[model samples]
Target: MILEEKKKKDEKNEKLQTDLCECYLLLNMWISSELLSICVPCLLKAASKKEESEDTRKEVEMALLALCNLRFIKIEQELYLNEIKEIIQHHQEYHNLTRLAYQSAWRFLVSRLWDDNSLEKVIVVEQHFAREAARELEELSKSVDWKKNKKGGERKEKEEMITTLRWMQTLSFFFGNCYLWNEEYVELFSSIVGVLRASRDNYREISEKCIYPFEEASGRRVVKIGSLWQSGAVDVALEEIHKSAKDDEIAAKILKFFMNVSRRLKEKKKDEIEEMKRKELKRKIFEKMEEEGYEDVVTSFHKTFDFLSNKYFFDDALSLDIFDYLVNV
Candidate 1:
């Protein structure tokens, strides 16, 4: 009886695997039909991890590889994009993308979506992916050995660090494409700030490799303006200031982030919730700056860059009530 049951189970497993392979083969052949729309969601779900088994991971790898080669028209993609978003956002595990296939699948999907010009359609998708990326960033930050310099790090450690940096670059690209206005986006940028705060030894690398690209891609307008404040980015900035006072470039970049936040806030039509959030953010910033003696850091940054080109930059930032409160107090 035991042998008969085992045989039945093995047959069932074999049939399921064969079915999955055939589905992948059909998808690879570019069969753009209603049938594919059904298959695509199934593939996404199959790729999503639910257990720790090696067999499960192998299934995920195979599904993602098939997804990497997915070819759908704009209309077909539009129809099932929400399904894709749901599967990717809620079903997939953030820490399980250790395989090259997982990375390639995401890269492929994002790049394909990059061609999409329907801002109305893609913004929500981008926001969901951004949150996922933020989760990934948080995981990477925790995994890193922040105390070690790059020269002293092991090869594996360095590879992980590089992966984290590349992830930041990816976020920069996403921010460029999507409007960064949601409160959830605050979580995303906050994660970026968190990573920057933790990786103290890689300050220059983060700035040059990550921050500069992010700044260029996002500009000042895409950000929701002061959303960072609601996400407690002020605290992260203060923490960095306390630890790395001598790194004026990074200090300047931090100030620029706040400045951009304040500057953009001034441009927005004030809703009551936003106004309330702004006041709260301003109060917290002032309290933390005072408690941490960050006034000196700002003073030092101002003195160093008290250049003619930055006169208007400081003026614009201070024009906001938040920066004005900081200055007067």
Candidate 2:
């Protein structure tokens, strides 16, 4: 009886291994309608690391490879897109599993935008990818700290920004065609614009216009911020700033983006008395903030923006030398 049970268990293991092998083969050779019905379920099961063990990592890796290639398959169903989003957003073991999810996302994206042989459809199917790219980049921007780092933390902050910048520059290419498909492409531009304005390096000259989102999102936010100074329009960004404060690094990126925007406008419009004019502008902004239900945050943002924009305005140092004063006297 023991030997019989052992034999049955061996057979079951053999069957699972065979199915996993077949899943890879189907993924590579092309999953037919018949094979897809069988392969996808098995692959998804194998791809999961509920145990998250090193022993099971190989299975997860293979499953991800299968999914990466299978992302080549055209899945038009809304349900499938949501599933992919959940996988990409899954945070349980994101550090280990996200690499595959990210790769699969890229593959899923490029496959749709791949333009080599087929007759073009009137409406492109690029919304899912553009939205995902935008969301991911937005998350990064919100997560990064724009505050003055201490000596030891400066390198870490720069590394984080550079990594996010690289991702934005690469994904912006894939998001280009999404403009015609859906407005999700606009979200991509908004997110990337936030990064570009905050980044120390210039990516525009590198990627060119192929990666540029649009004038309305990039230039407006970095320069003027169309309606951000208004009471009604400030809520969305104020909320983002509040959330950033709750994170590991106390990010000030969203606020910095707006501050820079405000500074640029002030520079362009400074034609009259400096101090009185600056006080009026600051008063108006504070009143708008007070009316916008941001009492807790308003004070902090107000002080930070004031300090950054007027770094030299408080200087009391005189440049006159004693010898020069004697000569003049």
Over the full model, what C-alpha lDDT does candidate 1 score relative to the true structure?
0.55
Off by more than 4 A, model 2: 1-10, 14-38, 48-62, 71-132, 138-184, 194-329
TM-score of model 2 vs. true structure: 0.36
233-287 per-residue lDDT for model 1 (tens digits): 5666666655444334555555555555444444434688877766665566667
lDDT of 2 by residue, 1-329 (tens): 22232247434563365355445554475656544554554455555444567756556556655555653465444313444445444532254454334544455435444442221121134225556565666666566664444455435434345446445444543433323334444555565556554442333222222223332232332222333333122334444445433221122333333434344445433556754555565556556555655555535444354343244232222122212111010
All models: lDDT? Answer: 0.55, 0.43
Candidate 2 structure lDDT: 0.43
Which model scores highest in lDDT? Answer: 1
Taking all chains together, each candidate's TM-score versus the true structure is 0.54, 0.36
Lowest summed lDDT window (length 10), candidate 1: 320-329
Runs in model 1 lying further than 4 Å from the true structure: 1-115, 147-157, 201-222, 241-249, 265-274, 290-295, 303-329
